[model samples]
Target: MAERGRDEESGKFTEEYPKEDFIKALKELESTGTTDIAESVGCDRRTAYLKLNILEEENKVESKKIGNVLLWELAVESV
Candidate 1:
């Protein structure tokens, strides 16, 4: 579930989506762009990148640099 927030002054709505949700989204995404990750989780790009890096360190995700864009994918387990 995502936490909802609203600014009193600007009346802008914000959602603090859970990282666990992103993990599930990443697994379903399989392979996708960096922006896609953020969009999937309703989080900012920087946050998505940070989480992906953490996942990479945890051996849960993989990344590849293709030209200027970095592609991310779920790490597959051996049968």
Candidate 2:
């Protein structure tokens, strides 16, 4: 398995799930929650949530709250 955090040589934090992988996961799903994205990307739910929010800020993805659930999907302009 890959190391959870930090790269030995670069001394920078490593991502268990790369942002590209996260985007790909989002593309595969129509609309899904963070837990589902995390499972698809093989990362933790927290990581998925944070990354998704970042994407939202970038306008790469959009989210909607349905009841207690937050569903995320890629932005139309992003596709």
Instruction: List the candidates' TM-scores in order.
Output: 0.70, 0.82
Pairs of residues clashing in candidate 1: none
In order, what is each prediction's RMSD in angstroms? 7.0, 2.4
Model 1: number of clashes? 0
Q: Report how far residue 24 has shifted in candidate 1, in Å.
A: 1.3
lDDT of each: 0.79, 0.89
lDDT of 2 by residue, 1-79 (tens): 6556888999889876677887899889879999999999987899899999999999999999999999999999989
- Residue 67 Cα positional deviation in candidate 1, in Å, after optimal superposition: 0.8
How many pairs of residues in model 2 come into backbone collision?
0
Q: What is the lDDT of candidate 1?
A: 0.79
- Give the per-residue lDDT digits (tens) of candidate 1, residues 1-79: 6557887888878545655776788777878887998998877899899888887888888889999999988778510
Write down the worst ten-residue block by lDDT for model 2.
Answer: 14-23
